[model samples]
Target chain A: MLRDITIGQYFPGQSPIHKMDPRMKIIATLLYIVMLFVASHPLSLIVGIAMLVLMYRVSGIPMKMITKSLKPVVPIIIFTSVLNIFFVSGDPLFQFGFIEITRQGLMLAILMSVRILCLIAGSSLLTYTTSPIELTDAIEILLNPLKKVKVPVHELSMMMTIALRFIPTLIEETDKIMNAQKARGADMESGGLMQRAKALVPILVPLFVSSFRRADELAMAMECRCYRGGDGRTRMKQLHYSHRDWIALCIMLVSIAAVLLLNRILA
Target chain B: MAVIKTENLSHVYSEGTPFVKTAIDNISIEIEEGQMIGVIGHTGSGKSTLIQHFNGLLQPTSGKIYIDGEDMWADKSKLRDIRFKVGLVFQYPEYQLFEETCYKDIAFGPKNMGLDEGEIDRRVREAAAFVSLSEEQLMKSPFELSGGQKRRVAIAGVLAMKPKVLILDEPTAGLDPKGRDRILGQIKEYHQEEKNTVLIVSHSMEDVAKFAQKVLVMNRSKVFLYDSVENVFARAGELSQIGLAVPQITQVFMELKKRGYPVNSNVYTIEAAKKEMIRLLEKGGEVRA
Candidate 1:
């Protein structure tokens, strides 16, 4: 049942996007996100969507996987669209007493839904292409300048990496504890709200106990490795931008320009 | 008659995910009544996954699991009834104990079955006695007991259900030598007294060899071998290949058998090996444990 929760599952590949320096990839992902709201017209949103699809393909990750990753967000996507359809104001194209459906409201709802979909799908491409290890490395590099302002960048990134690593381990432990409780005749499924909440105590207690044990072991292991922040520690895989990275950046810049130009022309 | 049987059973995980796996694939095994079955496999070899299916804790992704020759999942409404008949004591039994008092915790399963107060009390006391827990221990908080005592209380919780086929996933794990022996001895005695099917899922070759009449070896989610203890130990070398082995005494006797001695290679216990060696040496100078 927990197999549905997909986080930090690296898609194995050797595509150009995957090969791009993690730093460039991080920047590109941010810039791509910025471009999502750069235009209001349907034509420009189409361009943004097409760009995301192109990036998704270049990431060498399967389209099916991208949708699979979006599954947990499906309810949220539907919720937001429903909310916007009701609240977004314009001339009422269809009126029924207290309810009104307008042309602009309907179009805005569609575009907003697509925007949310593309935003999730596009960024998931970044995570799909770059492993969590590389993503944290890129974050540390980007945050290095803030170290002058006393922002414990290394410690923050280290914490992020550790959390990322333990996500699956914790989930597995949860599954084990859940099954153990299930064996004890703990009725988890058929119950009222209070009964269901009470049933989870057996699972949660064990999970919490094991998680602390694992954390204690991990801290000791890290201390054994002489890990005291990112001080003078070099990484095995260095981040370096190539000519192709520069070309990719320029292409993204051109796309933003096209969206802006289209926005102005349409306005 | 077999208490539990699987017909071409399989469990495929993460069906469409990139990291999909088939934990138990096309496994068909019959577990007869009153037999101590030792299912051994390395970690992640579907040992846990396979056992969870015994009581319908897991619905098979494919095929069927029959409990007492009845389809376990045929009536989804009464699957919990199947659990009462196939008691699964998980690896860390202590984690399942949540009631304020040990008595209430032990009574949980029988209570879930809607048994009467008299029946629950009788089952709880009998199960507690089987685990060598005293009457005083039942009233105390289970969380207050020593780890071994806590483990015993958790185990009795399942035993109170009086399952026809008791499945323990590493019942003696984390116990000291004495604790391990005491617990296993109790389980064996329970099996003798009740004549119920006992399946102990463990990685310890010694424990299985010392007790179980049958051995079921699993490697990479598939049945590597399954047979009577003596028949399986005769192929000790193949067992070692999959990170398993015959009992130490059997290993030595098998070696002696290889060296043209009259030692019995099927001897799985030190006492049996010692007796065989004594008889063989009296006949000639022959065997040893």
Candidate 2:
């Protein structure tokens, strides 16, 4: 059941997005997020959605995957949208007993929902296309300048990479521990909240113990290989910005400029 | 009545994903009561998957599982009770030890069954005794024990539940020869005293040959053979074809028979091979007077 988590999971493929430089993908995702918030007009939102649709098609990730990523955030979307509709004051559109949905409030709610959906889908696309190793390497390279200020950029990135690498391993361990406990008749399901939480003791204790053992062994293995920080470390697969990255950057700039221009003219 | 039965049981992992795999396929078998069955197969031959279904740790993608003639999934709420009825000690079970003391660790299962304090204590002590865990060792934290002792504690945890059917997956894996024999010996003793069904999934054919009354061979996610140990090991050729070999003693006897010696090639254990060797010598008219 834990395997169903689709968020932050890499989807291996040879699609253009998958082949794009990880650094470029990261920049593109951030720019897209910024553009979504900056755009005020519906026409700009349409343009943003259109670009997203085209990117999704080209990435070759199935529609089902994007929908799966969206499933978990449904509650958040509804909660925020409802709050916006009732809390934002404007021309009254629907009113009932000290509760009202205003014209501006309804419009804001719709926009917020769309923005939230697009934000998740766009970011999820980046993760789906970029492998975790490449993502971490790109972050380290991009943040290299922070080292001038005595920031431990390399160490932080190394930590991130190791943590990301161990997610699946830890997940497998948890699955094994859960099954072992369940075989002992641990009732994880069915029970009051407290009872259910109490049932997790058998699973959690074992998992934590195994995790510590794994961490200790991993550290020893790393030390045996003479790994000492990231000083003078060289990557086997070096990052290169190809012509496609330039084209992608140009498209992103043009879209943001167009969105801003249209918003100003329409306003 | 068969203590455990599966009707065309099949398990396909990650079913709807691109990584879909059929771990077990169309396996139908009825394990009789009071039988010690050894499950043997190459890695990924579905040996682990099959035993997991018996205890409801895994639900078959397609098929029915019955624990003592009652459909396991017929009532979802009773699955926990079913799990207690079919105890499973997973591979590297010692890693599941988490209690402050070995006694509490063994008591975890019985406590989960909602047994009274006295009953839980009694079962814990009995299970510990079955595994030969000393009173002092029981008070020590399970984390403080050696790998073999931790393994015994984990197995004791399941035994304390007093399940009708006990299934152990590679219980002796990664243990020294002495540790292996000790654990398997205790399991054999427990089976004899309780007369409960025991299924031991093992890679070592010798261990199974010495203890199992019956053998179940799996090949490519299907039951290759399920019969008496003699019958299963008799087809040494077919067994080897699937990357599994009969006990070494059985192989030696087969070679002896092939060398034109008037020897029965059916011996699978060391003791049986010794008896066969003495019988062959007596038949040769070489008796020392």
Candidate 3:
């Protein structure tokens, strides 16, 4: 059941999105986030949503996976939308008991929800297209200028890559540990809140111990391989910005500029 | 009556996703009470998946599991009782130890059963004794124990529940030869003394040949062969083709049989091979040494 978690999950494909440069994908995701916030008008929001739908289709990733990624943030989405409805004041559209529903408030709520949805969908698309290793390489390269100020950019990326790589491994280990405890008659399913929290002790303790053991072994293995971090490391597959990457960047920039123009004109 | 029976059992992992895989397919088997059964298979052959179904640890995608002639899933509320009745000791069970003291760790299972303190205490000591753990060791923290001792404590934790059928998945994995023998010996002794059904999932043909009366061989998520140990080893060629090596001694006997000796190729254990060799030598038969 825990396997249903799709955070940091990558879907392999040969679509144009997948073939784009990782650095461009990261930058495009950032641009998309900015566009979602900038597009306050309905027309611009429609454009943003359409762009997301187009990317979702072109990426060739399963639609179900994109929806699944939003499942975890459902509560947050509802919270923000409810706040928008109650907090935003304008001409009243309707009134029931103590709750006044304003036209502007209603519109703001819908806009906020759509923006959040687009934000998540756009970022999830980037992760779906780029592998974790590639994402780390892009981050390191993007942060390369910080190296002049004595920042350990390569080490930071290495840590990120290792953490991403071990996520599945740690999840599998947790599953095993939980099963082993359950087999010994630990009632984890039905209990009061405190009782349930106590039940996690068996799972968490073992999981923590095993993770430490795994980290120790990983460090030893890295040392044996003569891994010296961040110093004079060369790339096997050098990152190159292709024509597709330039086209993707151009499209994102144009869309962002259009949203800005529409927002100003509508205002 | 069979202690455990699976009818057309099948499990598909990550169903409805691109990662979907059929772990076990249409597996049907009946296990009698008090039988020592060993499960052997190549990696990902569904040996672990099959045993997990016996205790209701996993719900079959489409199938039925009957324990003591009753559908295990008949009452969802009773699944907890099923787990206590069919204890499973997982691979590297030592990592599951959490309680401060070994004694308390062993008591974890019995305590979950809601047994009285005296009853829990009795079962805890009894389980510890069954695994040959000393009283002093039981008082020590489980983390302080050696690797083998920690494993023993983990096994004792399951034994404290006094399950009617015990299923151990790769119990001897990652252990030294002596440690493996010790744990297997304790399991055999427990099965004999309690007369409870035991199923051991292992990759070691020699370990299974030495202890298990019956063997269940799985290949590609299907039961390739399930029969007496002698019978299973007799079909050594088929087993080897499926990436399972017969016991080392069995291979030696097969070599002897090929060299014109009147030997039983069905011999799986050294003791059995020795008896067969003595019988041939005593008959005054012309044998090439």
- Candidate 2, residue A43: CA error in Å? 2.7
DockQ of each: 0.52, 0.76, 0.87
- The candidate with the higher DockQ, 2 or 3, is 3
Q: In model 2, what lDDT does residue A67 have? A: 85
TM-score for each of the candidates: 0.92, 0.96, 0.97
| Tens digit per residue, CA lDDT, model 2, A127-187 | 9999999999999999999999999999999899999999998888899998998888777
Q: Rank the candidates by DockQ, best first.
A: 3, 2, 1
lDDT tens digits, residue span B248-267, model 3 = 98898889889878877888
Task: List residue ranges in candidate 2 displaced over 4 A.
Answer: A96-98, B283-289
RMSD value for candidate 1: 2.7
Task: List model 2 lDDT by residue over B1-289, tens digit each.
Answer: 8888899999999876677899999999999999999999999999998998888878889999988799999998889889898899999999999889999899989988999999999999999999999999999999999999999999999999998889999999999999999999999999999999999999999999999999999999999999999999899999898899999988998987787677788898889888987787877664332
Model 1 ranges off by over 4 Å: A86-92, A96-99, B99-101, B135-146, B241-243, B284-289
Model 2 alpha-carbon miss at residue A109, Å: 1.2
Superior candidate under DockQ, 1 versus 2: 2
Instruction: Determine the C-alpha RMSD for candidate 2 after optimal superposition of all C-alphas.
Output: 2.3
